[model samples]
Target: MFSFGLLNLFQLFFLACFCEPAHALAPGSSRVELFKRQNSTVPFEENNGT
Candidate 1:
């Protein structure tokens, strides 16, 4: 029973982090927004100048 509760607590933490507004998670930190922006940013490709 204790293990189940622990698991639930972790799940709740993830849900809150993913569901809450970016500002709510970190007041003025913009951590969540940074993650969202990272997902949309283009990844750099290896430029092998042959």
Candidate 2:
């Protein structure tokens, strides 16, 4: 049980270290963008403008 706990701790530590670079350079990543689209049609709106 102790070994399992130790392994889990090491895994968590490795993940924390691995993710550091992502957050450090997050602002410069061009693939990241923010956009919003608005749909004005009501839920019950008819398909044709009848």
Candidate 3:
């Protein structure tokens, strides 16, 4: 019974480690999209200037 509890704890730990990065990556991808949009628009503004 104690070993089962330990196994569950380890599973939870591994799940947390994997899920933590995926959660962070969700926002990280949005941040990258915003950065890409800013970069893409800067060229449009420059083209308008010319």
Candidate 4:
């Protein structure tokens, strides 16, 4: 249970690191585009697939 909570925290951190730049770089961009950009750079998603 403790590890699960830690994993959630890590996910949030990664999300912040990932989304923050998109907002800074293009504040006017649509959310759909930001999501596509995020999906393209999924370091964790690749690992999960393996």
Candidate 5:
């Protein structure tokens, strides 16, 4: 029982370590995608205006 608990703790620790970076980057990546989309649309708008 104690070993099982220890194993669960280790798994949780590893999961947190692995997920931390992905979770941290998720927002930044989404922001970059939004920025890219905005930049791409600006050219289209200007072309339409011309």
Candidate 6:
């Protein structure tokens, strides 16, 4: 019984570690996609002191 409980705790720890990164990466990927679009549309204009 004690070993069963330990196994369950380990499973939850792995699940938490896996899920946290999946959640973090989803937004980062979208941000990179948006940056690509912005760069494509905006020309690299040097701002002469306006």
Q: By the lDDT metric, which is better: model 4 or model 5?
A: 4
Best by TM-score: 6
Alpha-carbon RMSD, each predicted model: 9.8, 11.3, 6.9, 15.2, 6.8, 5.9
Segments in model 2 whose C-alpha atoms lie over 4 Å from true places: 28-50
Given candidate 4, what's the lDDT at residue 1? 100
Candidates, ranked, lDDT: 6, 4, 5, 3, 1, 2
Order of candidate numbers by TM-score, starting with the best: 6, 3, 2, 4, 5, 1
The deviation in Å at residue 23 for candidate 2 is: 0.5
lDDT by candidate, in order shown:
0.74, 0.65, 0.75, 0.76, 0.75, 0.78
Q: List TM-scores for all candidates, in order.
A: 0.39, 0.51, 0.53, 0.51, 0.49, 0.54
What does candidate 6's lDDT look like per residue over 1-50, in tens digits? Answer: 99999999999999999998687568548666567668896665545976
Per-residue C-alpha lDDT of model 1 across residues 1-50, encoded as one tens digit per residue:
99999999999999888877655667546686567567876764545974
Q: Select the stronger candidate by lDDT from 4 and 6.
A: 6
Cα misplacement distance, residue 44 of candidate 1 (Å): 33
lDDT measured at residue 18 in model 1 versus the true structure, 0 to 100: 84
Looking at model 1, report the run of 10 residues with the lowest lDDT sum.
Answer: 21-30
Give me the overall lDDT of model 5.
Answer: 0.75
Give stretches of model 4 more than 4 Å off.
27-50
The runs of at least 3 residues in candidate 1 whose Cα sits more than 4 Å from the true structure, single-residue gaps closed, are 21-50
Off by over 4 Å in 6: 28-50
